[model samples]
Target: MMGEFRDFVARGNVLDLAVGVIIGAAFGKIVTSLTEDLIMPVIGFVTGGVNFTNKFVLLGAVPESYTGSQTDYAALKAAGVPMLGYGAFVTAVISFVLMAFVIFQIVRAANKMAPAKPAEAPAPAGPSEVDLLTEIRDALKKA
Candidate 1:
């Protein structure tokens, strides 16, 4: 049973999957950072510094004890106010699209750099063993 377990662990598929999962987690962090730190800020600047993450419409009553800005999404949420988070949804959508595009471009570049499979070996040109044997048999019959 231990040998079986070792064999399973040593299989290429399992190792590949583990490596892929680790890389995927790291890539996800990179995409998230790109979206939140770099892309979103540039997009906000292009749209006149509109902060999408903070944009929300409150549907519930504001708590009387709440001292924070009513328009602030985090504050309102913390105060137990129900709000529609369209801006957050939009931001998530944009991030997803950006990550997808980046991954696609990466895969495209990888494919371009990968070496192609070599062509199949061609058959030999001389007469086959069967043909030679038949010729020898005919010569023997003639002799």
Candidate 2:
């Protein structure tokens, strides 16, 4: 069992998969940050500052007794408010679309850069065995 386990862990495919998973997770975080921190802000600014992350409605209002004066989605949620988190959903959808588009572009560029297969020439025709034998017989008769 130990030997089998060691072999499985040391295999090239398994190690490559582990590395891919780690890199994918890190890339996901970077894309998420890029969308949230950079893209969304620019989009919002261009669209009259319509902030996407804060665009949610609360089902329960904070009681007047709650001294904290906060109005963001998290604050509303922390106040036991039922909410529709549409902003986060939209952000996620946009991020996914962007990621897919970037991946497609990368793959397309890679395919374009790959070497093309060489064109093959047609094979030359060869004489039949009978034809060769006839020629040989004629030469032998002449000799």
Candidate 3:
């Protein structure tokens, strides 16, 4: 069992999966940062300084107005307030589209960089032993 587990861990597939998971986590953080820190802010500025994330209608009574990013959508639920999170949805959609585009571009580049398979080897060229023997016999008979 221990040996089996060791073999499993040593397998390239397992290591590849682990690497993929780690890379995915890192990519998620990068995308989130891009959306939150740079892209969203620029988008907000472009569209008349409108912050889509803050646009929501509270279903329950909140003593004060909500001031938070789309990440705080869960907070409204925790506060027992039902709200239309269109802005959050919009932000999520934009982030998803951006991330998808980045992934596609990366995949395209990787495809271009991938090494092509080598061509198959040509078949050997040699007469059969029987034919050679026959030829040898014919030559011997003629001589």
Best of the candidates, lDDT: 1
Model 2, position 26, has a per-residue lDDT of 88
lDDT of 3: 0.82
Candidate RMSDs in Å, in order, are 5.4, 7.2, 7.0
Residues 23-142, candidate 3: write the lDDT tens digits. Answer: 988998898788878888898999999877676666656536655443466777666566777877877888788889999999999998999889999999789999999999999999
lDDT (tens digit, per residue) of candidate 2 on 1-143: 99999999999999999998998788889889999999999999999999998888666666776665455776776777677879989999999998888779988999999998788878888998999999999999999
Candidate 1 vs candidate 2: which has greater TM-score?
1
What is the per-residue lDDT of model 1 for residues 17-113, given as tens digits with 9 covering 90 to 100?
9998999889888888888888888889999999888988878788788999877887788778888988888878887898799889999999999
Top model number, TM-score: 1
Query: What's the TM for model 3?
Result: 0.68
Please rank every candidate by lDDT, starting with the best.
Answer: 1, 2, 3
Where in model 1 is the C-alpha error above 4 Å? 115-143
List lDDT for all candidates, in order: 0.88, 0.86, 0.82
Return the clash pairs for model 1, or none: none
Cα RMSD for candidate 1? 5.4
TM-score of each: 0.71, 0.70, 0.68
> By TM-score, highest first, what's the ranking?
1, 2, 3
Q: Which scores higher on lDDT, 2 or 3?
A: 2
As a whole number from 0 to 100, the lDDT of residue 104 in candidate 2 is 91
Q: How close is candidate 2 to the true structure, as a TM-score?
A: 0.70
Cα distance off (Å), candidate 3, residue 31: 0.7
